[model samples]
Target: MLTYDVVVPVKLLAEAKTRLSPSLDRSARADLARAFVLDTIDAALAAERVAQVIVVGDLSGHVDEVPAGVVVVAEPEPRSLSAAIRHGIAEARRIAVDERVAGERAGRRSTRSHRGIAVLLGDLPALTPHALDAALGAASRHPLAFMPDAEATGTTLATAAAHTRFEPAFGADSAMLHRALGFHDLSHDVPAPLAERMRRDVDTIDALDAAVRLGLGAHTTAALAAREDRGAPGDHRTDAQPSSRPIDSTRKGAA
Candidate 1:
């Protein structure tokens, strides 16, 4: 049914979600980052089209927080978002090759099929299994497919067919970049609710509020609940500023 090895790359908590610093403290931001990843992974695992999930990043001190059965690939050297995605894709390829070789050596007819690799952003706190399944199902029809973020300028999810090289261009205006590179935009193909929820990648206070309204993952919900319990302000309204600009968290020491 077109299963995929989903790859999610996350930056260290200490360096993540810096753009929200004006509204959230360091510890709160870290908790939110961890919650986002946990929720993202959980949703990906729950998707029917997902075969495996690979988390690539410097999560040494936080490995235990990840759910069981998900694979973790350490990023010893901090690198660009594109580089981290390449590393995760390479690891997925390596595992696939190893399994094929093992099957050949065992003289057993290989039952495993070559599956595509899906790169999912870790900050999609409002992502749902149904939305992910619908997206993946639509993506399977194209050799390369991508969905733009809620603003329609950035990319939130990208998928490449089995055995095909996924040259990711994830930065400012990444949606245009992927389209320029021939990745079909699958944004309109998914269900309306799925498209709306899936594109809501939380980066700013406003986006976080939108995610909360749409229903956040358990980790994010709890994190926000704790903050509310402490009498911390939960208003996510932002001052006049351009929300279209992308938030690049991969820069070294951004926080």
Candidate 2:
């Protein structure tokens, strides 16, 4: 099995998931953003191939909510989604070097070698450990690999070998960009059960309903339940807009 250092970049709650505003209030949307990230981190930690999980962003107020053993790199200085991802990857590399040095100093044999870094979207509430593990397993076969989002236009997950430069092109139509940059498309070749689940990132009410049907992580489920209890509009379904509408560009980057 290959072990990966997973990097998840999240925007501050106040600026995330704007498209959902039609159905949910600002506070509800913020809560959902946090829930999605928490669920994503939980699933990453549970994955067998994940050696370390690093969350990079401005999570100042919600730092306490982060689970133990997960590293949180605060980006108080705001940057682009791609920049945040690069920051997280740098941190993962630092951690990997530190671990190797510590092992050498202690004259202890390291049980595993860090294969490379993996970037996962923060909004994948339906993500599961099994699915992440399978994706990473498939990703290990290539020096660079990416999985497209359910829409097949954006990238949900990407990986690069330890020695390779991980320049993440993670914005609108990132799947095509990554492919143009020579990153292998692993989803079509692998087509594993977990890959399907990992690709369903929720950005709209219809996507949220799809995730709910697929079963969400505990945090997301609780957040939605709370919203329902508050009588939020839409109830995860509304005919306010067509599902085929493009995702807002403001809602495109980061988790």
Candidate 3:
């Protein structure tokens, strides 16, 4: 049975995707941020095993606009990405506990079926629903699994439950940190899937260019298409705003 829920942590536009500054101007960077948020949610929702797509962070007032089938949870203040993920774990735990106490959910939280949760990075441009499902399908075998970035140097996807002691060090050496947490360390398996066109994240202009160069995931592709259709002119852009307000750490992970 499908084992766990999916948690996606999105960083604020002003604070996230700053490294893309080399290739994209501030406006473009912000646009990419918007696209990333929308795309990640879309991918999460499309996954078959993903019971819930928990968006943990300050939504920048776009919570209502998130694609249908996704759940938005707002953090009241700015917190580290790692903290936000930890919060998601707690929320998933609560769901599991509630379900277990009331009556067991078939695949949602099976005590006999290994419990796992996926912490999906928010900026994946090459992400796809099918690829995500395939990755989770692989993870169903082992209780823990880690899907790293294209470079295999950094981890982009991590699987664990609230009790798994998943400590996230969201900087350099993230892969090692995840391995230390007892995650399945698969570099070539999930990260290198050929059919998975949308797994690359947008942290640099290089990444953005690569995504554009190589096609985008359905969510990212659709978002960009929508943006193009809407036609953001000089002042009509929704991504022009900048805010220093940090992502909140408060736990509001309810459905």
Model number with the top lDDT: 2
Model 3 alpha-carbon drift over 4 Å, by segment: 76-78, 104-115, 161-163, 194-199, 222-255
lDDT (10s digit) by residue, model 1, range 181-214: 9999989999888988788888777677678778
Candidate 2 lDDT tens digits, 80-181: 797888889888887777887899899987643546899998999999999988888888989999999988889889999768888979998899999999
Clashes of each: 0, 0, 8
| Whole-structure CA lDDT of model 2 | 0.83
Number of the top TM-score candidate: 2
Cα deviation of 149, candidate 1, in Å: 0.3
lDDT (CA) for every model shown?
0.81, 0.83, 0.63
Ranking by lDDT: 2, 1, 3
Give candidate 3's error at residue 113 in angstroms. 7.9
Compose the digit string of candidate 3's lDDT tens values, residues 103-171: 554544446224677788887766778777777777666657777666556766777643566555555
What are the models' TM-scores?
0.89, 0.91, 0.76
Residue pairs whose backbone atoms clash in candidate 2? none
lDDT of 3 at 253: 15
